[model samples]
Target: MIGLVLAAGAGRRLRPYTDTLPKALVPVNGDLSVLDLTLKNFSEIGLTEVAVVVGYRKEAVYARKDELEATYGLKLTLIDNDKAEEWNNAYSLWCARDVLKRGVILANGDTVHPVSVEKTLLAARGDDRRIILALDTVKQLADEEMKVITADGQGVRQITKLMDPAGATGEYIGVTLIEPEAAEELADALKATFERDPDLYYEDGYQELVNRGFQIDVAPIGDVSWVEIDNHDDLAKGREIACLY
Candidate 1:
């Protein structure tokens, strides 16, 4: 399966660090960047062909891309989202439409999770649907995280930006294996949402899919060590979790 890494965001939450470099390139642990850790995790999972969508500090991302390809012998496809300043991550996915057609595994570039993602991908068996790895976060999720609300213990009822701490079912772990056709449908919905309001977040498209009775399976990753690097504090937290592996 093709691996699609969304690294196009400006990472405004990261502040001064992001002011100098893309958030994906921020140093983690001793030397590895978040993007490097993500690619290494993918490599461990046997995903070799990778498409990294980059926009903010695109040159830095490209330079790191070169370094990764040289070091890992990884075949890296770099796609630029020129409109990243105006659009959200759904637009980044739209930029990689060609690869998305073959049922690619999608991930955010800043997440530092264990290398067992290969098992998660192998577990995927449904035909032409979106499979989201939903982690049961009984611990309070941060406000910026994307959350999923479920119904009947199976269906994804809604995907929303975490605003209310009370009603959330779990935090979405930023990994999804989506069938090409379902991705296309999501792309169309994303376009429509952007047409209506270009500033609307990608979660709106997911909510639309859930409202239309689309079956997005929630593959539970309960208590699996995962941390998303969004700030300096998050970087420290991710490094701590990375030690578990």
Candidate 2:
């Protein structure tokens, strides 16, 4: 499986930092960027090939592509998301659907987490599961977080930011392991999701999969130190915990 990163969104809330750089390029640990950390984690886990979906200020990534490849010792496959500035990540993810044939361990470009998160997901992979998300049950869920609801054997029944926080089992930390078996259906679901509403997130696509009778399971990342950098506050917190990772 290849490492897939969705780094296309234009983080308007991040202003000047994102003005010329994609959110993934925002440095968390000294000179190491969020993308750097992800690549590092993927490398440690022996994924020598990585695909990054880039848009918005994609030139920044292009400029550093060679260097990133050399540093991580991995070949880079850069996928372009033409609608990145206008649409949400449902489209960004769909843009990389072609690469899904090989399967992927997907990481949100803006998330800062340790290699343990990746290791946990890799360890949990099995033939019975097609899509496995890294869920954080320990974190306090808010309306803005992508919350999840699971059943005894039904696996993930719901995944959306609109769900009531009280009923949620945990928050989806934007990391997912998509098996090759799930690729076509996931691509179709994402296509339907984005075609219906450009503003929909990829988590909505997961809901579409559930709606179609497909079970998407969740693996709890038990008390892990991680941050999804959105605004300045998240970036600050990301920097603080990134060094520990």
Candidate 3:
């Protein structure tokens, strides 16, 4: 299976850095970027072929494409998302629909996490042809997180940004294993989500699957370090955890 990374959004809160580069290109360490770490993590899992959905500052990614590929020893496929600056990530992910058929272990370009997170999901994915999300069950709940509601505290009942933090079992940590069997249906759900509203998070696509009686389960990362880079504050935290990775 090929790996995927959605590096499209214009993280406006991160100004000067994002002015010339997409959030994925932002440096967490001295020279290594969030994309660098993401590709590194994928490489550790032996994923030599990967696709990246790029927008916002698409030129920036194109500029670094060769370098990133060389660094991770990966064969990179770039998918363009034209609505990146105007719409949300549901569309960004949908832009990659045609390319993802072998299944994929996807991660958001803006998140900083170790290879262990990928390892966790990969291990749990064993022979199960379902979407498996890497969830942060150990982290405390917050309103800003993309919370997940589970029926058995294991099977995802709902996944949304609007869910009440008190009722959420855990946070969907922006990384997932989408098995091949569910790819077509997921593509359909993502299209429906973006068509209904141009601003829905990609989590809504997973919700659509669950609504259609598909199981979206969670795998706990188990006390691992991870941070989603949204603003400067998150960038700082990302830098801290990046070093540990």
Candidate 4:
């Protein structure tokens, strides 16, 4: 499976840094960017081919494409998301539909996590599992987190940020493994989600899949040190935890 990264969003909360570069290029650990860590993890997992969805200052990624490839020792396919500034990540992810056909270990570019999270997801891959999300069961859930609710024997029942935090089983850690078998349906779901409302997140697309009777499973990352950088505060937290990775 190839590695896919959704790096199209313009993190407006993070100025200056995101003014020229996308959120993915924001450095969490010294000169090593969030995208750098993601590529490194993908390379470590022996995924030599990777695809990245770029928009909102795409030129910055273009400038670093060759260098990133050389550093990771892997070739990259940059997918364009023209609507990134206007729409949410549901569209950004749908833009990579063709790449999804090959199956992918997907990561949000703004998340800073250790390679173990990816290793955990890879280890949990089963024949019956089509979509497996890295869920942080150990973390305290908040309204800001993309929370999940599961059924007894079934997989995920609901995944959304609108749900009450008290009722959620865990928070989705912005990492997922989408099997080739589920890609087409997921792409369609994403399309429907974004077309219905451009502000919808890709997590909403996952909700659409679950609504359509898809068994979306979850794997716990077990007390991992990770952070999703959204603003300056999150970036500070990311930098603190990234060093441990």
Candidate 5:
């Protein structure tokens, strides 16, 4: 299986720090950037062939691509998303269609987790299906976090940014294992959405798939230490969790 890391976002929320560097390159624990940890996790999971989607500060992200390959002794593929400024992650994924066709483990660049990603990859079953990692209810979740609502104790009913506290069933941890057929369907849905509404975000693509009655298996990751680094506070919290591993 291939590993696809979506790191093309401009990270406007990250502000001044991202103004100088890609959010994926932001230092998390001393020398280790979020990208570093993500690549390391993929390596541990035996996904030696990896592809990174880059946009903002593409040069810096490209510069480290070779370094990661040399350090991990793995092949690294780089795909540029020049329209990152105007599009969302759905567009990024759309740009990596070839890689996705090989069946990919999709991960967000800013997310950090302690779970065994390889185990999760191996746990995936069924054709034309998706396995989404759903985080348990935490003490608090930011408004920007994506929430997943599941039904029948098996499938995802909807995925959306937290708009109401009472509506959220769990947070989406940004780790997903998808079959090639499902990836193609999602890509088609994303393309249609963007064609109709150019400003649509990536979460809208997920909602489109759910609305079409696709079966997305909800994998509950309860108590699994994971954090998404979007700002300085998240960086500190992610480091704290990383220190425990």
Candidate 6:
């Protein structure tokens, strides 16, 4: 399986930091960037071949490509997104559909999590061919979190930010394991999601899969510490967590 990262968004709330660099390049630990931690996590877990979907000041990432590859000991596949500034991540992910059909572990560029989160998703990849999402079941989520609700069989019934926190089982940590068996369908779903609305999140693609009678399961990461860096406050919290990793 290949490791994929969605690092296309402009992250406008981040301002001057994102003015030249994408959100993924925002340094969290000294000189180590959010991309650094993500690549490190993927490399440590043996997904050494990675594809990064880049846009919104993507030149910053390209400038550091060789250094990043040498540091992580992974082959880099960079996917360009021309509409990154206009569209949401649903399109960014769909842009990578042609890159990895065998399988992929996709994570958001702005999220900072430990190797444990990747291990949690990898551990659950048994004979099951369904898509598996790493969910933080223990986190007290706010409205901004992409929440999921499970069915009786632990299948994800609903996944969206629109749901009430009280109705959610957990927050999807923006890490997903897509098996070869489901990659094509996922791509189609992602395409449809973006075609319907350019601003839709990739979780909407998961919702499309669920709506199609496909079972998208959730692997709950118990008591795992992670943060999604959106603004200055989130960046501060991410720095603290990055130090622990």
- Quote each prediction's TM-score: 0.90, 0.99, 0.97, 0.99, 0.90, 0.98
**Which residue pairs collide, candidate 6?**
none
Off by over 4 Å in 2: none
**Whole-model lDDT for model 5 versus the true structure?**
0.76
Candidates ranked, most accurate by lDDT first: 2, 4, 6, 3, 5, 1
Residue by residue across 1-245, what tens digits does model 4's lDDT show?
99999999899999989988899998888998899999999999999999999999999999999999999999999999999999999999999999999999999999999999999999999868999999998888888988999887788999998999999999999999999999999999999999999999999999999999889999999988998999999999999998987
Poorest 10 consecutive residues of model 5 by lDDT? 127-136
Residue pairs that clash (backbone atoms under 3 angstroms), model 1: none
**lDDT of candidate 1 over 36-121, digit per residue (tens):** 77777777777778999999988887777678987666789999999888877766777787887777777888888776654665
Q: Is candidate 3 or candidate 4 better by TM-score?
A: 4
Root-mean-square deviation per candidate: 2.1, 0.7, 1.2, 0.7, 2.1, 0.9
lDDT of 6 by residue, 1-245 (tens): 98999998898988889888899999999999889999999999987799999999999999999999999999998999999999999999999987658699999999999989899898898857479999998988889999999987758999999989999999999899988888799999999999999999889988998899889988888997899999999999999999999
Model 5 agreement with the true structure over 1-245: per-residue lDDT tens digits? 78888888877778887897788888777777778887877787787798999998888888787788988767999999988888777788788878878887888888877646445545655644564554555636657778877777457787888467467777877877777777688888888777767777666777888788777776656567778887778878988877765
Model 3 lDDT per residue over 1-245, tens place: 88999999899999999999999999999899999999999999999899999999999999988998888899999999988999999999989887657889999999999999999988897646478999998889888999988876448998987878988889999999988887899999999999999999889988888888888888889988899999999999999999998
Cα lDDT of model 2 by residue, 1-245, tens digit: 99999999788888889988999998899999999999999999999999999999999999999999999999999999998989999999999999998999999999999899888899888858999999999998888999999998899998988888999999999999999999999999999999999999999999999999999998899998999999999999999999997
Residue 90's C-alpha lDDT in candidate 4?
96
Query: Lowest summed-lDDT stretch of 10 residues in model 6?
Result: 121-130
Deviation from truth (RMSD, Å), model 4: 0.7
lDDT of 1 at 92: 75
Q: Indicate the TM-score of model 2.
A: 0.99
Candidate 3 colliding pairs: none
Question: Where does candidate 1 stray beyond 4 Å?
Answer: 127-129
In candidate 4, list every pair of residues with a backbone clash: none
